[model samples]
Target: MTDLLIRPAHHHDHDAIWSILEPILRAGEAYALPRDWDRERALAYWFAPAHHVFVAEDAGAVRGSYTIRANQLGPGDHVANGAYATHSEARGRGIARAMGLHSFETARSLGFAAMQFNLVVATNSHAVALWTSLGLREIGRLPGVFRHPRYGPVDALVMHRSL
Candidate 1:
């Protein structure tokens, strides 16, 4: 874990970032994105002007990535929102946790007062556990909001934490 470097993403990282994103999206389990989304569309969302994108590199190879952005505009922008992804081969290595911690700091540094995840899939136990461990509390639950590929219609959690 000490070997991991979390830094702002560069233009050259599009391919690496897409590589990490494809499988996750294709699986249609963790995130709500379309399974057939092309690289251009995925990269556009990841690198959107409002998103502060980053990548985690270990031994000079990109292994994970995340994006921090305002949860909304105007009055709500004070609260930040984030999304994360890791290389399939790099799971269980603490990359997501490390990235989550870094994201809080990065969001706070960007003047956000808090962080919120609007639609965390309830079936994703790993993410729910990590967010709780990181001090985010479940503020609300939307029943059957996420249609998990295997689990059918599953609940979603709205989680938040003050930065």
Candidate 2:
């Protein structure tokens, strides 16, 4: 794999970041986002005020991106939640794993005591396996919750790890 740099996303990186996010959102398989989400709205969601976004770059090209934010409001604020997306051409390159690790450290630095992935699409075995390997365990399962575009009503897992 090439040298990958994980850094805080800048305002100018919007286009490159969107290139990685667009396909993932449109796929409607991994995330619970709208399939027909437009670019403007999608960008707004990814860069929402509550999220701290980051990107993985290789040779100055954005390869992946992620967002870190509080999992809930008020009393549940100590736990962090994150979402990741890798560019189609950059899969299998360990970009997601690197981003996950970085996100954990970032979460800790931001005063988060734990990290929770509230909606890990069950059919996304790669991600499930990755999170498991990273020491996150399935804490809960929502049966037939995710209406996966291809897999129909599939389960969604809640994976969590104490920081």
Candidate 3:
């Protein structure tokens, strides 16, 4: 594994961040995002004012990105939610794992009591295994909830772990 530097994303990282996110969004395999979403809207959603965005840089290139925010409003705000994306070429290099660990620590520092992934596409087996290995348990499952591009409607799991 390379020395991955995880840091808060800045305005100048827009292009680099999008480079890592676009392919994943287009694939429509891991996330529930609209496949036809344009770059501007995608960037806006990922870098929204309320989100704490960060990027994993390896050898000066952004290999992955993730965003952390309150899972919901009011009473449910104590739980944090997050999304992650790694460049296709960066897979199997531990970028996602590094980012997940960073998000866990960041979430705790932000005062969240726990972290939850509202929708983890069941078809994304690698992510399921990774999150599980990281100590997040499958708290709930919404059967046939995600419309995967390749595989018809698939189940989505709600994973949670104390921060």
Off by over 4 Å in 3: none
Give model 1's TM-score versus the native structure.
0.98
Candidate 1 stretches with Cα past 4 Å from truth are none
Q: Give the alpha carbon lDDT tens digit for every residue of 92-144 in model 3.
A: 99999999999999999999999999999998999999999999999999999
Report the CA-based lDDT of candidate 2 relative to the real structure. 0.94
lDDT for 112 in candidate 3 is: 98
The C-alpha TM-scores of every prediction are 0.98, 0.98, 0.98
Q: Which stretches of candidate 2 lie over 4 Å from their true place?
A: none
**Count: clashes, candidate 1:** 0
Residue-wise C-alpha lDDT for candidate 1, range 54-111, written one tens digit per residue: 9999888999999999999998999999999999888889999999999999999999
**Global lDDT of model 3:** 0.93
lDDT of each: 0.95, 0.94, 0.93
Q: Per lDDT, what order, best first?
A: 1, 2, 3
